[model samples]
Target: VRGTMRHLLVLALAAALLPVASVAAEESDVVVLTSQNFEHDTQASTGATTGDWFVKFYAPWCGHCKKLAPVWDELATELKGVVNVAKVDAEAHSSLRKRFRIRGYPTLIFFSQGKMYKYEEKRSLESLVAFAKGGYKDDTEAVDVPAPPDLIATLKGEFFGLLKTVLHYSKHPEAISQESAYFLAAGIVIGSVLASAFYLFLSLASPAPAKRVSQSKKGD
Candidate 1:
């Protein structure tokens, strides 16, 4: 009876640890690709008999990348059967980084049938899974390239809207003076002028011949 009780106690202890071991094994199943394994794994993914391919380019030192780690892990687990989720450390993979022109950490790239798309914003696990499964539609339209009138018109519309709101709010029982309206108009004008000046400054600063030459040679 003593030996049997000891055996039962050992079995109970093993059973208690079984779940912990299972969780560890599940985590270990997430494929972590480094610079050394990137090419081989990506190639295998391309030739694989099943699933879409998704890769995240990240650097160990980036705070945002660190924050996104658990989200990526959850995405990996949730979409395990539907997608091949992998990660590449950008700092460790100079060639891959250059090839992809990865300007930032935590950039998620999706590939299907040899075509690729870059996810340029933060994404939730559900969204990521839906994207992998081709169930989500990106509703965001491409940004309209700013025309000179577009900015001026937008500023004008915003000023009018603000003026309307201010007038409406001022009609309350504790209404303030109309001077507040003038102040708001002045502020809007000042802000629009400043924004236009800043935009012009950036435009002028961007096309410098020397800067272009420097950038061209930096990669070499």
Candidate 2:
């Protein structure tokens, strides 16, 4: 019983601290635009000579969006300071989704020369790189890419995934930081209580020795 309690406590603490790591996992140099900044970031003025803008609209909960996330992050890093590479959460900003005609969860849009261009190409590393660097013509689209089957899930397993989510939410910029802090504090308190209970349970544990007890009755 005490062993089981200890294990549970450890798991609880680990779960609580998971989100802290997920925030870093979710972060990248790629600019994540919210509803407030989507227009300012993507909308270019007439004759505006700013760098080309490559924006990928995604839904946070979309599996396709999840697969595209790392690739988009890489594209942003490679084209950093050369072209503007960013992402918008369509689910979070429904107005932008409707305005841009984002029918799908992972739509790619590029703005350049004071015009908006929809990218309908493959989302592979090479394809995205080429599209961003002006290798593709105005109308080029490819089949969508999907994650591999029989693949080892990211974060090694669900336990780690849960942990990452916890950490990510705890430090999420959009959500109140205090909420996460309080959550972590509560987790710690619960874990400590469980640990104490486990310790006391163990300290008070007294197993009767089968052979010794039987032999001791005769001695008595």
Each model's TM-score? Answer: 0.47, 0.51
Model 1 scores what on Cα lDDT?
0.53
The digit string of per-residue lDDT tens for model 2 on 69-124 reads 78888999899988888887565344456556689878887777656667776789
**Candidate 1 lDDT for residue 187:** 37
Candidate 2 RMSD to the real structure:
16.6
Clashing pairs in 2: 18-163, 18-167, 19-166, 19-167, 19-168, 20-167, 23-168, 120-141
Query: Which candidate has the highest lDDT of all?
Result: 2
Q: How many clashing residue pairs appear in each of the predictions shown?
A: 0, 8
Against the true structure, candidate 1 reaches a TM-score of 0.47
Off by over 4 Å in 1: 1-26, 44-50, 135-220
Q: In model 1, where is the ten-residue run with the lowest total lDDT?
A: 16-25
Q: What value does the lDDT take at residue 185 in candidate 1?
A: 38
Measured by TM-score, the strongest candidate is 2
